[model samples]
Target: MDVMQRMERLVEQLNQYNYHYYTLDQPLISDKEYDALYDQLTALETEAGMALPDSPTNRVGGELLKGFKPHRHLSSLWSLDKAQNEEHLLNWNNRALKLIADYNSKNPDSPLPAPTYVVELKFDGLTLNLTYSDGQLVQAATRGNGTVGEGILAQVKTIKSVPLSIPYRDGTIEVQGEGIMNLSVLAKYNETAVEPLKNARNAAAGALRNLNPRTTAERKLSAFFYNVGYSDGISFADHREMMEFLKDNRFKVNPYVTYFDSFDGVMQELHSISDNRSSLDYLIDGAVIKITDMRTREVLGYTDKFPRWAVAFKFEAEETTTVLESVSWNVGRTGKITPLAKVEAVELAGVTVQNCTLNNAGDIERKNLKFALGSRVFIRRSNDVIPEILGKVTDEQDGEEIIVPEHCPACGFPLEQRGAHLFCNNRLECKPQIVARITHFASRDAMDIETFSEKTAEQLYDEVNVHEPSDLYTLTYEDLIKLERFGEKKANNLLDAIEQSKGRDLASFLFALGIPNTGKSTTKVLAEHFRDLTAVMSATEEELTVLPDIGGIVAESIVSFFADPFMQASIQKMLSLGVEAKAPEKSSAPVTDSFFSGKTVVLTGTLHRLSRDEATERLEALGAKVTGSVSKKTDLVIAGEKAGSKLAKARELGIPVMENEEEWIKLLDGEQN
Candidate 1:
């Protein structure tokens, strides 16, 4: 098929997939298969130099806009009157019934029916108005002054459930919905976000209002349509019919819409929605009740600020302003200090909150909390998350400044500034650092040292001078048996665990070493790249940065660590005490079970074409055990540039060796061929 035809077909398929997955919650295709199709379409578009008008790729705005334009809405988006209590709700019902009675009395022969109510969730998000023209999405805006709003068409396009085009092509229509970030999506984003969003409401509103459309796309927003604000050629008989019309046109109408025949039923549904809102994926501040009959709404409508037909039954508020009485610093496993705010006890979202996180020192400055101590600050508590300090109530510097600590709060060591954080570098003398390092080393993903705990690390540090991880290898019955409440079996078990830890694979050993700015995935990549502990330790930053996942910061951390004399001595001592850190063997590497099989090989210096790791891998693939040193039992040695003492010793021991790069590679290559 031609490129344009192919692109059109792909866009239609992907949009249908998106509708099923996002709106209907029923995925028609697996993620991998969908991605493959998407990739093919993206390549074709790139090849053709243009994307189809309805392409899913339009979700990302090609460029940032300077500012939002004012959107003059076709129909004014009216606000709903709020009912804070059952009495206020009853008053609203009485007013609606009275209006209907007056209209019926005037028309005597044709009377309005008793009002049935349509109840829906009042979503706690920014109100969005979307306009569609001739089957295609044309504009999106925020509800600004009821009649005029700020255009956010690019931002709204990022919402996958908002169809770029609809089935209705005869005329234009405007649909109203709430733009929101799902609670689960917000939680997941916060898990890895550098600056976590304080709450879902602000996160959604701020993203949609942002000048950069990329920000909106990254937030993964969703929307639920409830009203057709303006329609040129279509009309509904009732609220249910309007909702059905919205759904038929592919709008994501909220499924919580319920019809209640009586005011008591509406009240019950309101109570039920408020009670069960905590279980919902999105946040809702209340439930809304609207007159179901279109004719009844027409007769009772037209208030200055709110429609007489609908009222929002608001639940309790979740945010409050509180006095920031004090601030305290707490240290974590990585020696990074975090600020915790002590606020005046305030009940919020069903809990009394006294403490909230200030995130970090930079965050304190960014939030203008440096001078907010003993001042009123805005705080919010979501249902399950810890309460957060949003900001100071005002920009006025009316209170004491929160001082940044120059020394570690726990160990009194000098603190060093790194990026937005302060770190304590006294790894040897700091109590928390030592304790945490030991505890992390014994973690399941690390060395798997059984019966080890932070309490045990603290006790060991206090009783014996176990300042470094290597010190664990030296513990004995004499050391452990003297500790308080230490039984014979306990000491033996501890020693056995320490002994067993020596055999942990290279990746786990690297992770147990606790290099800063590195994670398990990074250590695993390092193990795969270097394949030998000595090679990894000796890897230069230039070499390290070339490997996958090894960025400048992590490479620098690894280099700086191994270059330290104390750290070097500790690792050497561990090896001397019989720690055997080796790479995990790959079973799929081509195995040449020939001459190199059952042979002990020694690799010294570095080949110009291949790294020491490469040579070691080939030797191991050929069934050779690559050792670090030359000895009488060593059968062969492959030496490269600046071959030193190990190479000389191999010559002295009369061990067969290949010193030329060409001959060495040829011999290894011949066996594999």
Candidate 2:
């Protein structure tokens, strides 16, 4: 088929698939089949130099925008008055009752119906208003001032759940929803994300407001439509009817919406929702209660700021204001110095908050915590993780300045600033840096030195003057048994483990070297690409950057790390001591430039060529992190027949997948070649 015709067909198919997977929570095809079609569609779009407006490829943004344009909403997106506690909610309900009673008394012949309510979760996310015309989503905006807002159509399109088109094509309509990032996605993102997100709310909001729509797509935002703000072709008699219309039109409606005949029932449901909010994947700050009757809402009308028919029952605050007492700097294993804020003991999110991560020197300055000592600061705890300081409660800088150390906290070596972080260059004299390096070298993913611990490294460091990784190899049983904690058996076991690690593959050995900005995936790629220690150590920054997963920073780090004469000497010494960091044989080497190289892949279903164990080994040998389950971190999935939830999940996540058994065999064949 021609590119245009083929592109059109692919777009229609992919859009339907997206609607099914994201909105309907079901998949009609395997991830592999869908990905094949998607890959073809993307290739055609690239060849044609254009993508259809509704293409799934557009779900991820292209380029950065210069600025946002203003969008005048079709109808005003009114805010809801807030009720903070039981007393406030009761007062609001009583006021609504009084208004209804007064209206009923005036219109005795044609009285309004008794008041009922529709309760929905108040999503703690950025408010989004989408305008559609003739079944096509035309514009999306923020609720800047109800009437006028920033247009973010491209950013909003990145939300897979937000339909690019709908069944309703008669005229224009406006739908109101909240854009949110799921907490689970956030956690998964933080696993490999260079800069981890602080909280879901900020992550969602910041992504939507970012100049680049690509940032929005990276956050994996979801949206739920709740209000038909403006509809030229349709109207609803109640909130329930409006929600039904939205769902029928393929818009995502939150399932938590419920109608109640009595305000007491609504109140009870609100409490229940708040109690179970922690179990939800998305953030909800409170419950929204609105009068269900459209006519009743018209009679009640709107206040200057909010709709008189609705009120937001706000939940208790998770954030707490605490006084910043001091800031402490500590060196991590990477030799990077991080700042830790010491706050006054305050209760927040059911935990006593004292210390919080300041991230780095740049973070402290950006958060305005550089001069925040003795000032009250806002702190938040998320997902049971460590509490983090948001910023000072006020912008006033009338406080003691947080000191930046010129020397390392662990050792007396001069500290140098690298971007936002400070690092110590003393790999030999610095006790903590060397100890941390050795500890990391013997860790599981690295050399797998069994029974090795930081305590053992510390003991060796202090007593035997063992400072570097090579120092450990030079030690004998006599050297280890002399330590306080080491018995004869313990010493012998440790020595054996160290000896066994000498035969670890080149990839593991490279990872154990503790190169900054280089992760396991990068190290594997390095091993696969160079295949020898000498070549990898001699690789240039430009050459290294061309390899998979190795960016400029990682390239520079690798070059700088290996260039050190001391590092070269240490490696030579380890080699002389019988550390055989051997490269795989020519035929057994991973395809250095394969698509799967350096990607975290998951294999599911039945394989025709090999068992799961053999496939995993081949994938690992091919430089892929073979995992058991599919997550955001998974880069690919090779599915066979009867591929179950894992394959479906891969489809839902837009992961690259292929179920072609013939192609699988070809790849396995290449492993032998």
TM-score of each: 0.58, 0.59
- Residue 386, model 2, lDDT: 79
By TM-score, how accurate is candidate 1? 0.58
lDDT of each: 0.86, 0.85
lDDT of 2 by residue, 334-439 (tens): 7889888889998875578889878788777766677889999888766467778877777789789999999998888899998878998876777777788999
lDDT of 1 by residue, 78-175 (tens): 98888989999999999999989999999999899988998888999999999999989999999999999999999999999999999898899999
Model 2: lDDT to the true structure? 0.85
Instruction: Give the residue spans of candidate 1 off by over 4 A.
Output: 47-49, 190-196, 328-340, 347-353, 357-372, 383-386, 391-673
> Distance from true position, residue 513, model 1, in Å?
24
